[model samples]
Target: MIHFKTLKQANHAFMLLIFILSSLFLSACSGQEQTKQKIPIKDEKTKETAVPLVKEWKMPISISADQGEFYKVIGWLSDQQIFYVTNLKQSSHLYLYNLITGKSKLIYKTENPIVNVQISPSKKYLLIHSSPSSNEGLVTIIDSKGTELLKKTFPSYDLDFEWNPYNESQILVTKFAEDWSFQLNLLDTKDASTTVLHFPEPFIKWINKDEIAYLNWNRNSPSLDAPLSFNGFGTEGEKTVFANIIQFEVYRNMLMTVSANKQDKSMADYSFFDKKLKKLFSFSIPQLSNYSDWLVPFYDYSEGKKQFITFKPLTSGDADTYSEGFQLIRYDLVKGSSEILLGGLENVPLSVSPSGNAALMGNSFEKIIDLNEKKIYDLKRND
Candidate 1:
């Protein structure tokens, strides 16, 4: 029942639940800038801009440190804008905040706590999640303009999504239950149509346009490793691609896997493979025993820069007690070089900017890293 090593289950949390839904909230809306909030002068020359009292790098609309931060940043839409989640009153709201303009626009709002918000691979659409109950999941797909495209509810304890790299309109989803029962389906976002894939594995990732790979594990006999298997999208198939692999992820046409070295249990090897599953390269990282059993470090992959990035601790130790912090390391595939982007930070959830120019780190995304300037800025601070 664990997906991608493990999942941190929020205790009986968050939803915008409806049996069936669409166009009901903001029916058939188009993309447009908000006319309310700030009205600029028609004659540009007549408008005067005020000078700032704080550093230019601070958030346009700041949240206080005492409020128990709720906002979780998704990522940067552009250098000046970002998408993040926070609750307003009893309702959860997604906001598009402009760093330069000091404007925050309501993108989406719901009475239920917004469980998750993810942008499409092309950055053209968003996938939002809300669970109405312990066994139900509701998904809302919208455009960058915040216009709702499709919405549906599923009978699931957990719902996982893997967006198709080749087709932004298609998605592979796994609906899970409390008892570890799951159903995998290929979903077409355009029509809300789905094709049920008859596969045994609960976790899967798209290997290519026509094939998908998954960690095939024995339910009856659990182990530290699983067989990496591949199956064609349209065919009923079975093929073991690799063995003794802990985890795998696919970015565009490249496949990456993390497996334990036979000779060393305390170290992990990351292997990169092309579309054909041919090993292109590999590297090693010291593993924290906290990540010892079934976990990996906070990591992200950037296809734009062909880099594998991770928050590596000073040394392999208990992941729970290690306060020495971590180094934000980036391994470049093209140049075969490793660079430390940032250091002296705990291993929190790492979300890199789409342009690879910045990263939001720490609880509530309270810390921001200017990847270009090599500067770290505090988003929320005590005055």
Candidate 2:
């Protein structure tokens, strides 16, 4: 999901943050700030609600602000174990922490700071990415135990990866040069062989077992939205089924998209569809008038709860000018209703826990949210 080839990047911190997050959702840590904003609710249905925390504990990690060291709460390896990384300038160490035992095991170590770390869809393998040069990247693939399986390097200025949910051993990797020239390869980890996948777009997600979808942008024409196109692995040709799609993401069984609302160009429509490409439902968020340059906010979908959550502002405005922060919203896919959960926080990245009970927030993963309890707690070093 993190890519830097677009004209929109322009050496912005937000663009860099998005890329770092997309690279296997590299995990975060720091002196936790409790600067949560208590913005007033517009309606009674989505008003503020408070509940006492049932459980509270420090995250088993620390940060050295003096040294500019940081960390990320990458994701939950299991309900009890969290996968994280301590990032220093010269080195980075990946760890798996067990909440029950309050212990962490070193998974892997790299000489350069880890830029990205990803777990396979089934949680069977780990992929760590590090940048050793401006145009070269080193990748380390390991099993769940941190046993090295493969290490490869790519000559790319930017990169994106998609783990085939149906085929855990096969990975789709796209490598892009500084000029935005790119190549897509289907990697067979078992044999170290790659088959060139001729795709036009750099950002593609597996829509189903064999089919992949991408925003088919006509780079020459440079339109605001692209056709959401699809192609199968064994098929020769491609098909453009939907139009005017700005962004799209595919999760376990849910396919999501962001596009300018057909009825109102000022609103960005968020829609969900099944693997069959059947439209499920959609809602809209305020979008800037210039749809082409609109920077969509961060969002994460919870597979277990069938919930779509994102940070959104109440009013549409310029993307970067808003210092007031956005509200956290949860759209229930099953119930077809939405609720405001939290508000007045920067547009930072967030990932939902697999169980859908908690979420880790901030670039450093400095805050933890109790989704069920409606509370946010600082995530700090246990010591």
Which one wins on lDDT?
Answer: 2
User: Which portions of model 2 show Cα errors greater than 4 Å?
Assistant: 1-54, 60-68, 289-291, 380-383
For residues 1-383, write the lDDT of model 1, one tens digit per residue: 22322433442121122311433544423222333222444435345344232247446356533322456777767656778777665567787877766666778776666778888877888898876777888889988889989998888989898887778888888998888788998888878998898888877777777777889988898788898998886686779988999888888878888888779877888999997878887888877764435457788777777877888767666767767778888888888999888888777876676667667777666667776576777655445
Ten residues in sequence with the least summed lDDT for candidate 2: 28-37
Indicate the worst ten consecutive residues by lDDT in candidate 1. 11-20
Cα RMSD of predicted structure 1: 22.9
- Model 2, 140-228: lDDT tens per residue? 89988989999888889977889989888888889998998999988889987778889888778887779898988887998788899
